[model samples]
Target: MTGAKSDHVAAYIGLGSNLDGPRAHVTRALHELAALPLTYLAEHSSLYASAPVGPQDQPDFINAVACVFTRLSPLALLDQLQALEQRHRRVRQRHWGPRTLDLDLLLYANLEWQTPRLTLPHPAMRERAFVLIPLAEFAPQVTIAGKTSATLAKHHDGADLHRLLP
Candidate 1:
């Protein structure tokens, strides 16, 4: 999907990786996101190390959040994210299983909608410290469901999240 001509919107994307040189996968994905046509990366959170949310047998994840300004509609942006993931050899064999890269659309200008292909505000973001902690770094004041990222992050006090880089 595409947006109105030249109408840029701010979007946040959640990134995580636990396989295939995880840190390099994330770093390279950031560059790919910034290079997407009609989009510019606005900000990015520091890299983080977090316990895997599912299937604990896998490696821990390196995660972060990135903010971008883009003319693409939510779905189009999602397509771009998936393409980048494919470029990094992401495979969808198991739910929340380890992967070379995972890119998620966390928010798009506060617009909330759902389709078979995507969901706004990421349905599970609020409950996951992996998403919230890094998101708070770049968007401390941004609210989801009336709660700031920082405030929401505090709710996940037991989540195993640690900053890995500035």
Candidate 2:
């Protein structure tokens, strides 16, 4: 006999924070992310310290990527992530400025999509070592935008990553 179908779909979420207790923000965000409807936090990599990428002169960011299993649609998942950000009082006053928390949907079960409000495979995940490293650690064989995490990290060279042990 076949088992009952699970209402679970795998996804990747990128977590980052650089202000108001960066480490605490990341930890809290993970808990909040798991609390979303039809979702479970499957795994997470240890945080990493990454140099700011845009608009130099910002605090170094604490970053990690989470693996989640969820039945929520991509848009719905995005909505929940935004709500978690708001709960932490995340602000968007400056581009890449410090914030309490930030959550980004990095990939959604190999589904390729782009909309005015969101994009899967994150559009820029391949070039960022911070994202690629944690992702490679958790799901090395997973493909994103037609490339494996290993390939993405190989192309990246991991120049500005410093692992943050928790």
Candidate 3:
């Protein structure tokens, strides 16, 4: 981050994978996130195992959440994230297909944004147990739209999730 420390924005990133040794991909990604330029990883949640949200044929996914303080604009951070995904050999053969890594910008400093390429407070994050369970670990009070993470997470049955590591 550059300029005043006030310039830094707290961003939440969700991580998941089901291919190429899922646990290792997620574990390595946690370290890689800390390496983002002008960015610092404030905290990260433990790994979790969950059923895939889309196709049922693929293996289960390993999921986690992270909070980062960064100077990069939302899109810039997104670009960096996509690049990291590519480094992991992510292939987009189909929607929600199995991949080596998946990184999502779940929230960006409580800002709501939209563009052809991306959206702040990711569209589906509110409903994903994989995303919420881990997010609650570091940011239970975080509010998106009119709901807080803790409140939103409260209603989920959590039967779809299994904590894997701390």
Estimate every model's Cα lDDT from 0 to 1: 0.88, 0.85, 0.90
Tens digit of per-residue lDDT, candidate 2, span 1-166: 0121376778899999988889889988888777888888888888998888787677889999998888999999999999899989988998778788889999988788999999887988888899999989878888876778878778776678888766
Best by lDDT: 3
Off by over 4 Å in 2: 1-5
Taking all chains together, the TM-score of candidate 2 against the true structure is 0.93
Q: TM-score: which is higher, 2 or 3?
A: 3
Off by over 4 Å in 1: 1-6
Q: Give RMSD (Å) of candidate 1 vs. truth.
A: 3.4
Q: List the residue pairs that clash in candidate 1.
A: none
- Best candidate according to TM-score: 3
Cα distance off (Å), candidate 1, residue 106: 0.5
Number of clashing pairs per prediction, in order: 0, 0, 1
lDDT of 3 by residue, 85-151 (tens): 9999999999988999999999999799999999988999889989988898778988978888988
- Model 3 vs. true fold: TM: 0.95
The Cα error of candidate 2 at residue 7, in Å, is 2.5
- Per-model TM-score, in order, reads 0.93, 0.93, 0.95
